[model samples]
Target: MAIRVTSEHDLIIEGGGMKIIDGRFGQPLYPSSPSTNHIVLLPENFLVSGTEQRISRRDFLSVLANVTRVMVRASYSTEPSAVYRLHSFSMQVANPSARGERRASAVEMCSCPPGYAGTSCEACIPGFRRVNGNLYNGVCEACHCHGHATQCHEVTGHCLDCSHHTTGPHCDTCLPGYYGNATRGSPADCQPCTCPLNLPSNNFSPTCHLGEEGELLCDQCQPGYTGPRCDRCSNGYYGKPVVPGGSCQPCDCHGNLDLSIPGSCDPSTGQCLRCRQGYGGAACDSCADGYYGDAITAKNCQPCQCHTNGSVYEVCNKETGQCPCKENVVGRQCDECMPNCWWDAERQECMPCHCSPHGSISQRCDVEGRCICRPGFVGRRCDLRRQGYERRETRRPVERVPIDTVQQRWGGPSRTGGCPRGAYRPKTGPLTHGITTGGQCVPCHCNSFGSKSFDCDETGQCRCQPGVTGPKCDRCSRGFFNFQEGGCTPCQCSHVGNNCDANTGQCICPPNAIGERCDRCAPNHWGHDITTGCKECGCSVIGSVTQQCNVNTGCCLCRDSFRGEKCNECQIGYRDFPQCTQCECNVSGSDSETCDMERGVCACADRTGKCSCKANVEGHNCGLL
Candidate 1:
């Protein structure tokens, strides 16, 4: 079996996988390549570290394994060198006299471990990390991230950048407010709580948590609201606040009903359920015939002040009390503004919302008419520029992150075999001609037509054909387009910008024109004027198939049986244009058979099929007189 290193902490021996057979700490390492994004592991000289387990070369090559991020430290080896050779004292040279013999020592061979190399076993290889001790004393071990994360801390082995809603030192559990089995390592193992009255904009609860029985529960309801979903109002309130545009207001009983017990007013309407001390009326707003003064109002009956915020408040009166609400409010002691209207304190009025039609989420605005803008746009009314968005910019395509482990969403263990899909362990070779041959198993990202080949180097840098740039060879250089295997062709359009369709080499057309060079008129217009575009064909519906035209003559092709310039009339011998028919007149008795219109003695009456007869002719066809 062949073996080689493909990245800073990975190896490839079989099955096109970038896994590590083994490694040790404190090896002298240099930068792998310019494009690899690998760091200078260590200086030319480094320490010789220890390890926990020792394995033979056979065990290392047979086992499929992996190594994660690590660090390199320095320490000197203290072992003394030993020579193992004997010298002969015989005068083998051509000097036959009694001459002194000179001796020489031979170099010895060392058989170090799989992770070590050197005449004296002084340096350790990569794929292992050690935080303590120098090379000769510290140990190195493989890193694991519990399948929930792809990477971990270099110094510590803690998992980082957790996914599938997991969080912890090892990503072994789900985060707060989420429930389910996180240890299963599946993306759907954990999930959000399904609240009963849940809404996209108005979730009345602060959070939903797991109950004692492991069931999801909405625990935190806002003030004046209660229930599992914060949908119901308290004893003294009314209205279905759970629904959109609904709010809970205090009972408008005017203090005529006793609220010591419960059910003093209607749950939806402000009408009192039961009046107190001979009181009667819709909200008990007036005393009964036998009742005395001040039965509806309290002893010191005064207006209960209100806290006018953006949302619903507690204090309230009847439907039309007109208590003069807060700055932006007008509901009888209510604090919230009406739908689609914002308060204008300077003018003391509620004006209709004026938000940007394209940028704002809705017409509703804040007290200052400030709208909630969409992403990449910002302003009080969602109309101002947001830096890079000042000019119309095309949106870039989105690239998704690669997943290392594959697991079932519903259930089951993870599936592991090699590097992530769309990735491969590149072939290993010496660096040559400013090109990196091998380093990592990364995505083979290259343009189909712009690159020389789809195969990428270890650092995922594709080889471009010529004028193609970008690491993926997806863009053309010098404002060129129509990229192909050999190179990119120069753009031919007059209004082309930096980019265009790389494969077609077509020009970006204006809204009113379309063609290879944006010189042709649109389908519904007819003219060469790009400024005003093509004028609308205005083709007669009974004549045109496209209901529009693109011809330079500014007219539509007439349908069968039609002849007028606008195609609105029938042909010479026919009557109804859309449902035209041939004229059949009696030839022998008629004056002429050709519907002669040149002299103005019109034809076989176009509408009646009657023939114009000669002199002495009287009957329909001049058969009798």
Candidate 2:
């Protein structure tokens, strides 16, 4: 098959025919001749594909070694049909039109073809620009006009009548909220004005118009609305209205038509001019009933609150709410209670009627100042207890009784009952008419732990339980045992803690004196007694062999040389030695001076021996000195 590198040159179509050209001039490497008709143009260091023809690597390299440039037409293959077919697949050259309608010869030079451009008419036109801009075997792409127009200006790329919302010369840009044509035509030229999804359709205008202001204006404003976009309510009007129809409502101003000044009221605020007499409020419609002061201002009124419900009529004076009083009730506004009924400021009205001293409840009575007494009480003022009525016990009430006759009655056994439990009656004279000062039965506050019984003696002393000896029986009794929190537990002294102090819980210590209960004597001390502290056993190094001494009595352990109980004195055998003096005798001598322990001396057998006697010379037994 023949390969046309360009319209000017064709690659020779022959068996295993291969070639290369100098890419710098884009021409054949060797001059074309009849024997070698085809040409191949390649850039420096180009890769060659030989699978199409099965050319060996060695043959392809040999052809690429020498590259040249030329402009010539030659025929290399004698098989014309295959060459023509190959040209149809890869390239197409046009035949020049005959001037006189004569048929053109096949041998005539081929002309540049349609849809092709460039010097050799081998490159696809601009509308079908090459992919990758490569001149060798590069595919061509048809120009995209963005669907706005069939074609675009070849060089400037300016498109005509860009599609909706699309703009730009190449129709490649989209308008805001629109998918096409962003740079051409007016902002809304191809854009359909739409309402925001959040805005209600009923209140918003039906259609949108985008004008020179570059703003979208609804076709018509709803009634009661006035604005460039008709999105806001007009003055004196409120609420969102339907498009081109509904209007806002004007403030009724409380419907005070007579007092309100015409056209003087604020449409939006509903505030009117000066209010009429006996009227107040933003609309001047509030009746100044039971009010006082200026009725024209917003804070015009003050309450009247008639005294004692004495107002002649329900409505009070126009200027102030103060009302005139009736003769029965007093005070400027007749707000005070009558003489019998005291005014209760906190309760804001006449309080309970003032009854006499013996009133049952807190001075509460009928309109009159009479007393209200309990069931058993009777009198004009409930001051006297009924003759036949007996006293009844009751818890102390919050209010004090005017006169407590029951509490002052005789304390001794009454004809009825004596006294309540936990209480005692005071002693009285035998059937005496007069009651004693201490007549009331009183309760004794004795501690439960101490008192054996709830009753108390006439002197008010509680009887204590066993093992409880305090005046209140609150502590352990002397010699009692087991002391704890419930009362005083006695000491478990075990004979050693005898006669213990009940309050301190300390028992008399044992004779040996030591332990907490004084049961035993401590280690080094001894000879303890109830009256005396333990004595320390004295053990001196000089008197005793070891520090250990007798634990029973205050005595030093003695050594062999020591004889006294405390080891301070020596034994009789060693009377003269402070530690332990032993008797000494002179065997050689036969004087009468016997061995003397106290002096550690033995006289010589006779006075003639000088060492036997102390100083003077003596006779035979030291009898004569």
Candidate 3:
């Protein structure tokens, strides 16, 4: 056995030898150099007493020397010939202790390798990123273009654009009432299938067909119809064209028949077969005698011939036998009198008779008549008076007596005691023999002389004084003026008298002055007398005074200080005056004396001084002042 030493500089050692010459020196033994040969051993075969463990192939190759040779012997079992065998071999030594040990650093184990990940260098395929982590447990994710989804990339997920009826997330579903194609990246179009009009569409799916079992089915009359198919008419059929949808049937006889009677009219013929006897027409509006029907039927009644005894009621119609009569008569024939008349059933007469004299014949008769005669008349006919005849002697007049003696003869109060103050009596009868007279002594009227001896007629009618009239001489005669003493007097001018003619009031006003008391004047005249009482200057114009006339021009009389025939207006340059006396301006000094009428300015005595000017003018002498 040979032991060889290797040099650090030698990468591959063959037939290796070790001798301490230079750092790169080698020696052999026997067939090789002594030093080199001993260090570098090569032999056919060798046996040793020391125990040596077998080396593994991997360990032996690690320490094998370059160019080292060895020999091995094998026995042949053939008897043909004994063979001497020379076997050549090489020797390689390795350290078996190095087995099951690691040579890499801890940092290298912790770091990820290029294009790999995780502690074990396990990662996704190239060009792909881990979705979760750097181990086989992680998922490989891919990147995708905008708006497009990737099929192989889960980490980057999917990118997709919404299709026609689909949207959101994975684009997995359709919109309401819409359905899309099944596949992705396709057009994904949607279809809509709504039900027909007047029908209900069912389900949310958009691909539904019209007659599908679960879809909406529409068939039938809209409303107000019937029958198995909803197309027939109801009880009261109504429509047009006489079809199944024709209009409803109208009531028979319509408005012409009465609804109160169930069989009033025939439904098929629409005619009234028979009306109640009192009734007529389709509506049965006829009335019987003495009764009337309303608009509805003739059988319906109203009273007729409503008039009293003397009055007649006329029939309104013969068929209905209805009569509208006069207010005073009533009954079927108007034969009976109203309660106001006397009904005489015996004669069948209504009498106008009343109580006796003013009323009818019955003791309790209500009628009225005239009376026989008045109370004062006593003859059978109430025309003649009773007679009586007798004779009497006449008497002669007697002589007069002194009133004083007659007064004494009365022995009571004087006969004049009851007479008025001015009344008197005349003596005509004898006193010594006591007066004998055929006529009775008469009373007398009162006189102005205080005598009561004047005579009066048997009726006491007195003769009036010269100017008096009236039974009592209480009033004056016509044309007389005085009212006292009940006598007349001459009328005075310009004064009215009570006894004068009513048309003229007795005074008789003078010419130009006229009134009840001569207090007023006629037009164009003034004053109270023909001279002073009346000034008639013919001032015919209105607002004119007597002085303004040609006959009396006292001052060319002005009205409201306006002097003119017409009195049209005030004079020029003057205002507010009975006479044109207001000066145009105030005189300030002797220099300014009078106001100039034309210019309305003061005339100045000294031409140099200021002038008293009218309103609107100023300066010396008011020259343009």
* Number of the top-ranking candidate, with lDDT as the measure: 1
Candidate 3 per-residue C-alpha lDDT over 110-206 given as tens digits, one digit per residue, 9 for 90 to 100: 3554544434444544434567752334555543322223332335444345445554455454444444342344543434433111123222122
Mind giving the per-residue lDDT tens digits that candidate 1 earns over 536-611?
6777787555566547777667775565555677665556556666555454556765555553332456667676
Worst 10 residues of 1 by lDDT: 401-410
Ranking by lDDT: 1, 2, 3
Clash number for every model?
A: 5, 39, 76
Task: Please list the C-alpha lDDT of all candidates, in the order they appear.
Answer: 0.53, 0.48, 0.38
Give RMSD to native, each candidate.
53.4, 44.8, 46.9
Off by over 4 Å in 1: 1-147, 154-158, 166-184, 241-250, 253-262, 274-281, 284-625
- Distance (Å) between predicted and true CA of 450, model 3? 18
Give all TM-scores, in the order shown.
0.25, 0.25, 0.17
**What TM-score would you give candidate 2 relative to the actual structure?**
0.25
